[model samples]
Target: MDHLTFKLGRPVTRTTSQFIVYPAESPDAVRHAVRLGLASPEIADGLLSPGRIRLSLTATLVAQAAPGRPQVVALELPRPGVGLDLRQGSAAPAHVLSRFFGPPPWTERYRQAWAEIANLLRAGDVTDTSVVVLTAGEPDRAAAVAEGLILGSYAFDRYLGYRRKPSTERCVRLAGSVEAGEMRQLARRAITVAESVNFARDLVNTPAKDLGPQELEDAAAELARDLGLKCRSMTPAQLRKRGLEGIAAVGQGSPRSPRLIVLEYAPARPRYRIALVGKGVTFDSGGLSLKDGKGMEVMKKDMAGAAACLGALRAAAMMELPVQLTVFIPAAENMPDGTAQRPGDIIRCGSKTIEVTNTDAEGRLILADALVLAQEQGHDAIVDVATLTGEAGRTFGNVLSPVLGNDWTWVERLLSAGLTAHERFWPLPLLAEYREPMLGEIADLKNASQMGGYTAGSILAGAFLAEFSPKTPWVHLDIANTSWSAADLGYLRKGATGVGVRVLVQLLRDLAAESVGSEARRRPRPRAATHA
Candidate 1:
């Protein structure tokens, strides 16, 4: 069963195997337990020892109890920095019949705590559950709890075969302080975002053999159909005809070929228009400039940028955000073959020509065509995300992603969105001098900087894309480092992390809100008139 089946309800008398979780900081814990009917004030006082709470077990079993009192399990909040340890044995109860949760304050750590809870839930495969989330009645805080659980419950075990088990049918009931209607709305929004993020993660985790350029196109087309969005695609020949040769040249070596997928969502009244361009290198073998075996192991994740855009589009459409969103994915497989475009090759990218200096530097080439396409469509702003450079990985070390852009306003806007979404991004300058190395002797520009070697590789790649959208407000994210995690950390597992989706969705949300406020200010007021 899917992990998203959740409901909201009022707290009731405890059934067998119920989990009563509350903040240790809550005043009169014993009194609260008596009211919930889990224990009498005298018994509850003995159940919790301030010293034992932190030093003892994560969960204490209240086995068979007296006739009147309920036999419910008790879990007191652990001290700060101590994680939730809910990984009970397989022989444990099948369902969480009920829960009494007094969620802690909504801090960054609090958000992470909820996510870790979700991870534990998924790991244990607890079934037919009902979670009572109290304390965080405010909309945003409540949503944070929901997001943490949903995102943490995400697992990519499709290929696990006999080892894989279906997700348990889980339910969460929100209670306390918050109104029922508001809680329901918050839950829906959080679920939408989590579903989209997991969708992107699935795409990234799939192997290249199963998800080539054509398969990626099929996925995008299917999502567009499901979401009622406008979808368009261009074949290799069509790309060449439109002078988008950079994309065609990159995929010429691979038999799977290349295609460009465009997904558009235009609401009845759009407040803002923006284009999202993502690099869709299904497998980056680096063409003739082949990478080592170690470098190519995770090459399948090269298409994570496209996955991010598709995922963001899904959330934006589901939420029905008042924005005109256009997504451009330049899909290709950069494999080395006799037909592949080698170094010293000249390719046309829109009106500009790019010299293939390093065939491994193929992401910028494809993005150049897609960015120009966005510009031709006259988008108000453009944001392109790609797993583009190893230099980015070396610089950030998975802690953050590097972003470079021609416009500070858009750059700052994206950074702000990252902060709100809990994604980290550090801005790098598009230094004018960096552009010189990109200038080519044979073509208008070279894909890689010959003189600079690997110096500022991420910045130089961003500079290459900046050429196509010079006049438009644009920001480029080199997510090479943050897209895939090396090990399971916090709520994120040891695979594709779906980094860019949150930032993109948050950016759209902020833009929509700003547009509404601006329009409100611009609206004309009805003025009282004297009798004429």
Candidate 2:
């Protein structure tokens, strides 16, 4: 399974059974190899020729129609020796290779394709041979391959004991030559991000019976302690004193109390102060409004945004980004009980009051308190992540996250980061006209909209968040859609996709770099100001 790269003229040796991709489809070479019994021209023709062929698992010996050999081998374009064709490189070619090698048990060809691509990325090159290396054999070439395989193999099968073992395949490996240092760094970063995402996924996947608001607070505190960051948790009384009525009201009905947990990481020479607020509704029973049986099934994932924020913080701290970061998580559960906040209840937030038209619209209420606290800390910019609206899912589906921000520059930068990370987000308008729906007669605003159903729920939520920070640069991420996927694709596994963690980390890194550059520009000239 060792991967080696050489130019065409170099001496070629194959000690063990190996697969090679030739550049040309010359009949002469095929005939010669067939005569020497070195390869099977028919098998080679089947693979090298255009069009897809799905060989049965029972089929043996892809190289020859001979008995007791490897099952069907798939081959496609650019032949072997012809240079890399970026246009022709695809999962189809890789699948052919997977069929040839026949991966180990419980592994899928798609996962192998991902591993192959990751290997090529680590090698820092892309060409015709790169595709072959990705598909032809076991991924033993680069350390980065190990990293990607470990990452793509994650599964949340903890609750599936009674169900039959899923036939779904997982696991991938890559083979290619790569620079050791760069490969190691890539592997390390991939592991760091994957582990963080897995952490978030685990938290989201946990049953509500075990991970209540208090438990979530403890988990955050533990993460802070482990990362050597400052952590603080506010009790119900403290929340009431701070006028965090939104969070308090939501949690009053549950046996588990509400908490406002803050984690801070201050660099020595901070360039910019960034605040992240997350809505951590551990479980959403929809309070007095009450969700039906169907709506309640996935209520465990309501805290997905909070989990992502926490995961991003962990990654940032681990990477030691040179920015002052403050993470605020308002952890609570919206449950139905005699003491629960009713639909008609009016709660006073930090700077304004909000009337609750629907108890299910509780995420915004908790975020209201958290955002106020973030602004009070005097952050230069703020980003809040929430599983706040189903309208977001209906609008953007599961692939794209909807982002609303006041600052165009920040929003653009975030979108760039999302693209680089392969996560998707679309910026939505925050028009002044949308503000009217949230206005309340008695209170400053209402959590539920008076009109405009799913058409603009994401934008409306963002408009509500804008009320707390009138002047501060802010971005609201409504990740209701991208947080989880029922099906697998690319490197993403099903359930708790941990979609925003990488994008957030990348954004923070970019922000830190910009802050450093700004600081350099703002440095005081010697004696110039005093003379002036």
lDDT of each: 0.72, 0.65
- Cα deviation of 304, candidate 1, in Å: 0.4
Off by over 4 Å in 2: 1-112, 115-148, 159-175, 452-455, 519-532
Root mean square deviation (Cα) for candidate 1? 8.9
Q: Per-residue lDDT tens digits of candidate 1, residues 37-126?
A: 221112322334443321221122211111122222222232332222232443232332222234443334545666665654666543
All candidates: CA RMSD in angstroms?
Answer: 8.9, 11.3
Supply candidate 2's per-residue lDDT for 416: 87
User: What ranges in model 1 sit over 4 Å off?
Assistant: 1-107, 129-132, 450-454, 516-532
Q: How well does candidate 2 score on lDDT at residue 206? A: 81
Lowest summed lDDT over 10 consecutive residues: which window, candidate 1? 7-16
Candidate 2 residue 369 C-alpha distance from true site, Å: 0.5
TM-score of 1: 0.81
> Model 2: what TM-score?
0.73
Give me the candidate number with maximum lDDT: 1
